[model samples]
Target: MTPPELDRKSALFLDLDGTLLEIAATPEQVVVPPGLPSLLAHLHHQLEGAVAIVTGRPLAQTDELLRPFSASAAGEHGVSLRYADGTREELPAGIAVPSAWREELEAAVQRWPGVLVEPKPHGFAVHYRLAPEYGNEVWRLVRQLVPPEHPWFHLVPAREAVEIGLRSASKGHAVERLMAHAPFHGRRPIFIGDDFTDEAGMRKARELGGIGLRVAEVFGGDPANVRAWLMEGAQRLDGRSASSIPTGVTP
Candidate 1:
């Protein structure tokens, strides 16, 4: 089926790594190709400031890369949110994982070479991308640290990493919350992502009367395709004539 075209009423929610940017050995290693920020800025204007980056990384990290061209954003899988007006909100108080757990997790993952423990204000992640062979071992260790039955925390496994965080946070809830506010409200939501963590946003988008586009085998499973798609859509939104739109390779 042909994908839906973005229009005036569309609100776009996008994932970062693997969707907008190519997945890297480590989260910090991901590259933001030239023109991406400008493209996002164009779409944000086209959509009337309804564009957002819903990512697993922190808003600070997202800002670090997308500075001077910010839009709405939900970071740490919805642990926090920032609107176009620059207002910020976070999961209610008392939802953070205990400091002791963070300390323990940090010390435990050191045994495995190439394994990195990234600490967030609300949770922590164990990345084994550099040491894919240790994926199972990393999961096993994380499971022990944050058992499945834990009341306040749960595990989110994605790519080659496992994140343990507050049970109240998720990409779906983030989308729902943003849609209830200005700009996003009354718009059909379109979410695009490329990983398991992105599925929640996808479902929420469809439920809210839009669609989810996946960057998998069909789209070459790469960020270039996503950029190309956005470029075409941006051109269309800009009212560029069909003949003037670049007929580049499909993603």
Candidate 2:
């Protein structure tokens, strides 16, 4: 679908991995471009603080990377949230992966060699991005651990990874929660993401009278393009045409 023209009333919900940032072999290996922080901050300012990041990574990790911005965000697939005010919330009852499950996954990694076991506050993810050959094994093992129709947890599939997160927690719920708060409420939502897990958020955006843009169709699956698109929106909102982008956006 064609992307809508961004406007003053638009509230933005963005996904980090594979959308704003290039997909990396491992989560830790992902590098934040030098100008991303400032660009996001400027966009946040332009939107009157209506911009929020909805990512699978934990809020602490998001903060560590974005530093001073500390924009409102949903983390751990929406199990955790940090509002625009710096207050945080964990929607689940401190739910964590079972010891047996972690041990089993860790053991499987030894056999898989390049597969990595990622631990989260709410659950865990098995990433086979580094070892694409083990993708089937990783997916099979995750399904075996938390099968479909499991009452408490569900599988969230990303590029080459699968996470076992609470079924009750989702990007859709996260978007709703964030939109209900100040600066975001009473505005149109524009959600952009690039994975199966992001579908929920995109769907919710459409339901809420906004647009959901897929990275592949809209920007040719390039993070640089996403950033440039956002900058264009900000410039347009700032009353500057695409041809007259001035020096830079201040953080």
Candidate 3:
């Protein structure tokens, strides 16, 4: 696939799992290439600190995965945030899911040996990738625990998992919040993501006069390809990499 253009005038928002990192069997098994952090850092610097990470993972877990490098980030699908200035948006209390829900999720998954309960700071997820036969049951149970009409919670469906998080937290809102700040306010936004949760952010990017790219449709469903395209774009932006920029093209 042809790499998307990125220049200093672009404000880039990226999704983590399934976009930057391959989705592992378990969340803890995902791997980050040795050069990914540096690649992201270079892009961040080239774009004048306009890059941001928006994901469903918690802020602390994001930090742990991308350690030794930092950028503006939205976590738990925007339930938490860390802006370019190093300050974070304080979350209001009583928004977290009930502890009973977590226990129920954990106990319910026991019926299917391979299904699992993944705990998060503000919420939790039920994964049944290994136990595909139990997918429907897992979904039904989770949906029953956190109903679709719930005032404060939402059930976010993913590749082989479903997440229970705050209804108010969404990637679309995260993009809007990030775009309101310096370095990103006037720049063209390019959001790239891989799942249903990312659709909101993608739509927001397009709505605000920017580009939204889907990994499956645009990059053939491979995070490695996304990384390669990003590297090429960063090189084009920085004018210091091995990538040869088109003589008359504006990137």
Candidate 4:
């Protein structure tokens, strides 16, 4: 067992869905666990601004979900950055997503049953949870619409669906970029997440001599694995605390 230590140079990386918030059928319907903002704020202050939420969701969505606390966020894998300093940065200027492609992808998904296509300011996504069988078909059409010239756009495969976003971003890249900045930089990276996309950040965090806590869900497969991982991670965090672990659950 790894002995817990109060390392001042520790940067905590967390994933929103299945980490800070529970995953839902639609991205828009997710519930923000009560007191999560406050708990994150406490963690942020305790870690001296070494806390960050690295997720596949868009940066703006992550910000909106973690209202009040708005801890540093890396969205769309890591292509976008929103720092504590109140600045948001996107990838290179040349990689702007063309509107035509967005509409094309949206139209393509509309024709497929159980496929929910959403438009992002930068890219697009095709949700196939309702029609899991169409997963590969959705990817085929999406791939046809995307050209290799767009260096910032790529497809990210999740549990039940595939998301197309800026290619330049990822959880691992976000962690690297965040650590290069103040407070987050120069700290040991402790990443917790429950998704295939999060593996990059986890691997990177371990390479940096920090811990990668995998949260597992109680049911389901991989997502469940993430929920379980988080439960243990929370316990680990609780055990090291001088005080009791603050429950986000309201009595």
Q: Give the best candidate by lDDT.
A: 2
lDDT of 2 by residue, 1-251 (tens): 56777788999999998888999989999988877887788788888899999999988898888777778899988999888898888887766778899899999899998899889888888898889999998888888989788888888888888888899999999998888888888899999999988899999888888888999999999988898888878787888765454344421
Model 4, 122-230: lDDT tens digits are 6667788888888888877877876667555777778687777777667888887788888887778988787888888988888888777666532332444443343
Which portions of model 3 show Cα errors greater than 4 Å? Answer: 1-3, 90-93, 243-251
- Model 2: clashing residue pairs? none
lDDT of 3 at 75: 89
The stretch of ten residues in a row with the least summed lDDT in candidate 4 is 217-226
Task: For each candidate, give its TM-score against the true structure.
Answer: 0.92, 0.94, 0.93, 0.81
Give the Cα RMSD of candidate 3.
4.1
| Cα RMSDs, all models | 2.9, 2.0, 4.1, 3.9
**Model 3 poorest ten-residue lDDT run:** 242-251
For model 2, the superposed segments whose C-alpha errors exceed 4 Å read 241-251
The Cα error of candidate 1 at residue 232, in Å, is: 0.4
| TM-score-based ranking | 2, 3, 1, 4
Kindly report which residue pairs in candidate 1 clash with one another: 225-251
